[model samples]
Target chain A: MPLIKEGVLAEDNWQSLADEDNLVDGPIVVSLERWQEERESLLARNTPLGLRLRSDQSPALVVDDLERFSVVALEFPKFADGRAYSYARLLRDRYGFKGEVRAVGHVFRDQFLLMQRCGFDAFEVADPAAVEAWEQAVSEISVTYQPGADARRPALALRRSRPAVA
Target chain B: MYRYDEFDHTLVSERVHQFRDQVERRLAGELTEDQFKPLRLMNGLYLQLHAYMLRVAVPYGTLSSTQMRKLAFVARRYDKGYGHFTTRQNIQFNWPKLEETPDILAELAEVEMHAIQTSGNCIRNTTSDQFAGAAADEIEDPRVYCEIIRQWSTLHPEFTFLPRKFKIAVTGADHDRAAVRVHDIGLQMCRNEAGEVGFEVIVGGGLGRTPVIGQTIREFLPKQHLLSYLEAILRVYNQLGRRDNLYKARIKILVRSEGIESFSRMVEEEWSHIKDSALQLPLDEIARIENYFAAPRYEHLDDNVREFEVKRFEDREFASWVRTNVTAHKQPGYAVATISLKPVGKPPGDASAWQMDAVADLAESYSFSEIRVTHEQNLVLAHVKKADLYALWLGLRDLELATPNAGLLSDMIACPGLDYCNLANARSIPVAQRISERFSDLERQHDIGALKIKISGCINACGHHHVGHIGLLGVDKKGEEFYQITLGGSADENTAIGKIVGPAFSYDDVVGAVEDIVDTYLEYRTDGEEFNDTYRRVGLAPFKEKLYAAH
Candidate 1:
């Protein structure tokens, strides 16, 4: 692992990202510019379980394909570009995206915590040093809201059970 | 007055521990800012313009003296000795460091308070009439229903991440003080032909870009079907609200796009399907929640308040305070005293720690320890006895909390605009300050009568500009602040969004513009018509004509 700035992504140090036993795994995302014949051939041979999507991907390609992949990665073009944040939330909350949702590419470390809070369980931080940071981030809190898909019990559940409202 | 049972306490306790864990992870470098943002937001923490702000919900604006004292303690201990009460009946502590929010939230939970749903797209704090259980004409105590809705909406799985934030206000009076007409969904309690209580549900009323007074979707929705009907509305909004455009995502937009008729139809259809599910109100549950809000044991006293009136006439300050601050309570011996959080020239709704402590003490002594925060940016001590009014008034005056401007022009509702909020296009507090200073004369303010001047830094309408009797909207004219004034708007029984009067004014000239309008109203008003009444009878034509005619 290499040293990563507080907010900078660790994507460039992809080779240094080490995986551990029973750890969450993220799919390798081919850059939009690299999606060519050679990439297609490589993908076909490898048969990866999912594809990391970019903002430029045509909607026709992503919508209504229920069985196409186990996960769909949404790239954060920039931290300020909240379009991807909404995209990720909508994909899970509205589009019924159930598999390993990952936030990858050009993401700020600060944003990673929020992204995970919004239901993105996996991240592909592009730096080696960010791995420890990312790991530390994931374990930061336990218990979450119920309205969203997070694990925190909804406050309503904590309500005192009553007989009825006459 | 929803008493915190052990279960409620445990839930908030666990929430604090969870947030603490989240903080640890951030320190450990596990949660990146991207991952941590929503988590923090869910806990009512926000990284605003200067520092992180934590907004704690004073659910339905109701609080006990003990709870208010806790708020004061947190403000002094963690914040910069003060907190800002918001229009949603919540309080925002400015200057809370990111690291300290979990502890602050823990403190809040200790007082049976939490920041849950203060942020996020879920149902925010349910607002009710500040006069809720105490109003003279209230058919039922509204806070009881508000608490029920709060519990039902908390962690509502299906509607948590709706297209945008949702607000609900309930009122039990014919003269709707809760501003029910300007909410996403406004529920007003009414009695049926058989004397059975029910709700009149209004949908789609909101005050963002496209302000619309809610349309009555159901003239009489049975009280027992409250949750199911609300569920139906939420379901329809969730399934259809536009997710593509952030600005056009609130249910208001959907209501506009689908048209009220079609939107109501969809909600009705949905209700038909799930109205009888677990969401339906069981008679016992309503009774159980109502028990928490039952009228406190009241000492049987003389209904005639003649002695209190004589005493007030004797004391000039007390007389003025009673005239401006006290509101009629249904109980003959009691009155609701509104402690103005807006003290003349100070920022609207900013209360110091010491002030809060004083108010808490006053509440304990004078009002059976019950306090409420109004959406109009005031603190209300409900259930104050007329016999003890002088003592409470004297104590409040000592703390500079007894400003005789409960619903007066000086009691402005202004947002944390550019000064604090990153979303603001211009500053709102200074504008409010200037107006408050301009109308600092008490006699003149009384002559002017009840007028609400709500200012929103941007079109988000957090300050509820759309519902103000006179609304000031701040806009950025190429990085410089400009304000557009509106008139004839109101948020009570005759709720309507204000109409834009004329041209926008620079910040310096904005106060003059308001004065000009007020003068025009005074000059033309027939008899003792209020700002809203005059504007309505003559229409915005007179004010608008007066405002821009000279220009």
Candidate 2:
């Protein structure tokens, strides 16, 4: 599945299989190996760069490389390993990567909201109907306990002040 | 106690609904077990050996009687008529089905509670002084600061995925009953010479396989810099803590490797950059959080020394309970009463639904309707009046809650070892029960004098065996259960890591070995020295000599 979304794919399209070469010029997908092979190649290119899935990769390394590439894709090899979720969050907040994070893998409908909250903008869900469900999930909750790219003030900070009435 | 404002309540309510949807999807086969694992864990639900376990955060062990009763209802309706109080001050119910977890969480939400971040690699429950508000030497209620940390660390994005789980403990008392020294980060509240209250920060103390007492990183941190200092510590830990080895990933190893001086310098360097940022506590906001914990309207009460003494002399049982279970409160007329969960032959820290409801009722009647759960597995009513001690004793006796063994040999800190927890290697509660029975005589326990016997079913140390004065660590030798005894460990002001005695003992011989050690200490004691004093003065050598003499 694709980890980065570009002009080619829809806002909801995120999954990319290994070099199924299935690209309609939607987004520039960069695998960890591919990203490493052409780190300078992607940085010099005029398109958004993506990082594809590696089964035994740490997100910390990819997060460290964010300054060189604009768009980074974090692949979920089997969907059960949550090291990617932590990577997605660290990439967005700690490393200050403000580009699209596409979660592509055995992406299911259930994890759509949590993935989104952890800073995944575009999700490559397998089923077509799952994408629509994911869209609904993102706007479902208006509040969260954590502070990340989505919100700055923690859930408590807002409570310290009173609402201004017009 | 921190009251849930609109934001806090809204966040939990939304999370409940979100988890409800996640649960629905899982049930419909839209989510696999692998997919649902993290989601359920973030909500504090775990699929254990037999059934799903839900861990509800207690937020520094402060709870209203209403909250306690609600927990009792959850235990009665959804669980096996009981709940296990964990060392982190959270409560775990072991028998909820997968499908029923969302509903249980929804019920928990009604009382401003949830199981969020309890089991996840994210921030676990923030534990603090159980005697927070009413401690004699407290600068301010530690719960307010704990609530602040609770808000700051709850689902915090940057620090959530550390090398492993993180724990924090805070103490605002002079005596440090909260065991701050053994936490990942321990905060001790102290007033500066200028009369401003601040924290003395200690970093890298934890228990598991590599147990190390936290070293002081900051001698005295300004009150307003609390959050910022914490950010520095966590940032350092998150970036540098060893993750390649699961066993060596905790901050203790990092602190040990980096050494305290270098680690403190690094934290200071990080703090210098973020000192004036948004993370620093704004003066106004500190007041806002502190406002909730202002002392309740208390009437001037007469000092009941004569009345209490008269009652104690009148009844031997009341005197016995007062001597063992009661503690001096900061308030003139108040005393802290610890109701022991370890009655003889009962599982340690396991409270049944009826017993919980009874404690809730008692809290309402005698302790200003509040109850606190200690990490040591005892419940405290922090504000009991001296005048009402006799009546409280009688009421507690009726409910079988008055064990009169608080801080004594019978008040054992035990983990639900092999019987419940999948991580445990041996049965812990049975060993505790056997030991309690051996020391069931009140006179014997009284003679033992402020001794703590902590039992862990395994090396996970959920029973806090490393810090117990007389620690019993359960190990499996050739698939046979054996106990490893440690002496001189403590979690108080003078915290010392326990030293192991001779060879590991068989299951049947563990209690006898403990009795022999106590007998040895009694024989070698000088005047009024307690077990720890004697152990310190004579060293573990004498106990070891007595223990393995006949072997």
User: Which candidate gets the maximum DockQ versus the true structure?
Assistant: 2
Q: DockQ, in order, for the candidates?
A: 0.09, 0.28
Model 1 lDDT per residue over A1-166, tens place: 2323333333332221222222123444343334332445535645444555664452225566534456566666644333454455456655667776666666544455556655676666555556556655544433332334455444444343444436
Question: CAPRI band of model 1?
Answer: incorrect
User: Pick by TM-score: which candidate is best?
Assistant: 2
Cα lDDT, model 2, residue B348: 81
**lDDT tens per residue, model 2, B351-424:** 99998998998889888888998888888898898988888888889888898999889988998888888888
Model 1 spans with C-alpha error above 4 angstroms: A1-166, B549-551
- lDDT by candidate, in order shown: 0.77, 0.80
TM-score for chain B considered on its own, for each of the candidates: 0.97, 0.97
